[model samples]
Target: MIKTIKHFTISSLLYGLLFTSCDLDRLPMEGPSTGNFPANEQEAILGLNGAYQSISTLDAASTPIWHVMDNITDVGYARPGNNYTSPITSSVTTDNALATKPWQYHYRTIARVHLVLDNLSNLETSMDEGSYLQLAAELRFVRAYCYSQLIELYGNVPLLRHAVGLDNADVPRTPKAEIQQFILDEMSEIAEHLPINQSAYGHVRASRIAAYMLKARVALYAKRYAVAAEAAKKGLEYAEGIHDLTSFNATIDVAGKDHRAGEPDVSNIFGHEGYANSAEWIWVAEYSIAAGNTHNRQYYGASRLGKGVCYWGPTQNFIDSFQALDGLPIDESPLYDAQRPFENRDPRLDLYCVRPASRFMGYQFQPQTEHRTVFNYWPVNNGSSSEPSSVTNTDATNAYRSFSGYLWRKHLDLNDFNSTSVSGESELNVGIFRLAELFLIYAEAKIEANELDGSVYSAINKIRQRAHMPPLTEGLTQQQLRSALRYERKIELANDGLRWYDLRRWGIATDVMNGYLYLNRAGNGWSTNTLQYIDENHNPVYNHNEATKHFTTQTVIYKENKDEYWPIPASEMDANKQLIQNPGY
Candidate 1:
């Protein structure tokens, strides 16, 4: 007979309140003790709320640490005056303040989750078996999530399972392979007990599907192609049961009028409303300003909009990758008349970026006047105004006034009607994992496993079809298929902060990023390599015309290295002597 621990309503309420309030640092009245043991229970639910709270707060959007990583990568370029650092593209050191901060936060969250797991394992209560299993599953999910972050950023991290006291804080680093295995094992165990359907916790909480998706992601990162494919297939099974493809109009519509009418196909997985619980999303971090927590939208909003605190522009490499509307490469497509570059390009380009002189939400986006340019195609001053305002050797005749020539388009809520509105505060759930990503994962895994002629074609074809791209020709070699897969992933996941990681994992960052930089300089009458335009008066404009030089151009070679892992913060090392720095840091 299993003895059951009585459910304490008061205790549960208190825990709920603490999590709902988003405060985990507060000291409990009973100190850190797990209280009395129960007779037959193998786990306790107490302190699990703290672990869940950590997940919600550590989201990349809301946390400055995650944003720091996003800004430093090639997917987005920081403004000239911005003080941001990224370990992926630049050499980040222990002395670098931003590089060291994320290490501390991640470790702190890990410590809390470890405490919950420790207490749960020791409990002897005959508590609700279902509840105990659910709590244990959630704890494992979060622990695996923390390790995933650590593995991606630091390469190897200490895989501490027990809650350590101050005296036992010094723990040695675990090997990267071992750490990844540990995470996979934990997620696999959790998946067995996690619920498959939506419940009281909502879509923001981890379900069995989320665990499987995470397993797939971690396996792919570790280059375990077979395991990745299996995990992705499992996740897709659940994802397919839930979401259908949203229509192109709904995906690109700023008004969201179709979405508001309860039209399922009109909502994206990332929209603020309508699709929060849609089948597309396997996991999301929920946010509401009324809850005293907000998602990170300030990074991309207009400066006139109160939250536009950071301006990380897009790169020329990204802009050039978008295929023409007819599915031909920009360089290959005859419709790609260099003079009018924006016309007839992939629809995603217009949906994902706000280019200079482009219309978004009925307002003209003039980069020179507002410093809201989309990509880094113009000259950027390094701390001083002494550098030439125009890019050297590039025609100043077609220069735009802004330093970065592109603005972020994804996740920006245009339907809010107010230019100054903070779209980040909306109740929309921020998707951490989605089905479309799973499809890409399956496609990549199959390609890597030398199964390109098998199911890989179907998976890749689905994504290409959505992008309106033609099917990849049959009989291509593995290397050719790999190239195609890489291109597909880039365009499909552009502006979603996946490019930097993908490039690093594929070991192609240097080759892809090292090249001449160019921007569409048509606005200022400067010819970007001899393209011409005309004014409303029908006057033929030369590359030197005022309209031609309005576009800006900035180009520089990027230095990259295998020292891709960020250095564990010196502060953490000082506190935990067992933590080792990654190689070449």
Candidate 2:
């Protein structure tokens, strides 16, 4: 018996309340004593709620930390700041907020998990066996999740099984493999006890499928291909009708009459309505303005014209990674036109990203300085009778406009446009897992294990079809299928916080990250001849000799051993004398 709890009704929206505070200065365990506080079922639920809240802390920008993570990777760029720059430049110090917050917050969650886990036996008499098992399983799932993120970001971390007092706070770092095995075993042990769908609990909590999916994802990250394949296959089989990709074909306000790109709006899936309606989300970190548990994603992610400062956007390298309309790289496909680049490109380019000459947030989103004013179609009285009128093109003329000349449109909801401000109070929920990602995980795991089959192609094609891209041809070589899978993950999972991990796990982080990150600050188009070739990973390689003269570029630095894992924070190393630092830190 791990721990026991008393009976109480768990709220459907458990994490909407203020976060439980614990003393975490010297170690994760120095907090309110977990022994007697959670004497009943409601306290246990509150303790568990704290654990979930710990993982979803927002940054100084009030953006979800997960959404802000990818901005420092090769796929995206962010406004100039030490928090964003240090990681990309590989100059991160142990005290850097970005590096330290995860270390601190995850351990804080582990602390909260231990609060209930250490004393569940107390309620074993009052709670039924099934209820007890489910409660313990959910607690363990959160602990496993915290460790999964820890091992990926920090390599080896302290594996605290229970809360410790200040006197016994010091603990040595565990081996990465040992912690990974713990996560796999914990997830496997708890999966049978969890429900397949947590819809009754607002879908924010872990379910049976979410457990297996987490297991699969951890196994895949650890390169245990067989284990990953088995777990992912089990999860997919369990998810048959309960979960599937949300369609974008619905009539959404993403496009206007003048827009040339086909309307493939994803706002219905990534916006407020998605959390309320879409079944694609497996696990979500829920937030609400009315509930006072919200973030400023709309304010940070929206463009200047949309009332945001444009803190982050995709890099030109990422923009060029989108395949042409014919399902081929732009360098190889004749359908690509340099002059009219937006046309005949992947609809995702227009759907997921806001580039020049496109309509976004009821405004023409041209970033070139020549356009001091652009057309706004937003109705005067917020009615349907409004006419298009010229408005100041802050996206083009503002000094603090988008640096990469593009804005992420994937999670930005037009419905939130009117409320976009510096308050950081947007109610959009960020997705942690989805059916499409599970399909990609299963496909990649099978391909890596040399287990070629129809299932692999079907998994990959399902995601492509949703994006309106052509289905993959039958009988592609293992290497070719690998490329196809990589393409989908890069494009489909762009700003969802997986690219940094994907680059490192695939052993291509060094090659892709240790070069110039090209930018088109003016939203200017370049010649097709500037494209040198597409790499094995489907990343576009450009002729820097000519590109340097036309586009502004940022230098990226990534050392081999040193950059693989973020350094154990200097504060942690000092706080725990038994802990040793990672390489080159």
Root-mean-square deviation of Cα positions for candidate 1 versus the true structure, in angstroms: 10.6
Model 2 clash pairs are: 3-120, 3-121, 4-119, 4-120, 4-121
Residues 35-72 of candidate 1: C-alpha lDDT, one tens digit per residue: 34222343234455445544555544343333334445
In order, what lDDT does every prediction score?
0.56, 0.81
Q: Which regions of candidate 2 fall more than 4 Å away from where they truly are?
A: 1-21, 24-29, 58-60, 250-264, 384-386
Error of 2 at 576 (Å): 0.7
Model 1 clash tally?
40
lDDT, candidate 1, equals 0.56
Candidate 2 lDDT, tens digit per residue, 381-410? Answer: 267665677898889888889999888988
Separate clash counts for every candidate: 40, 5
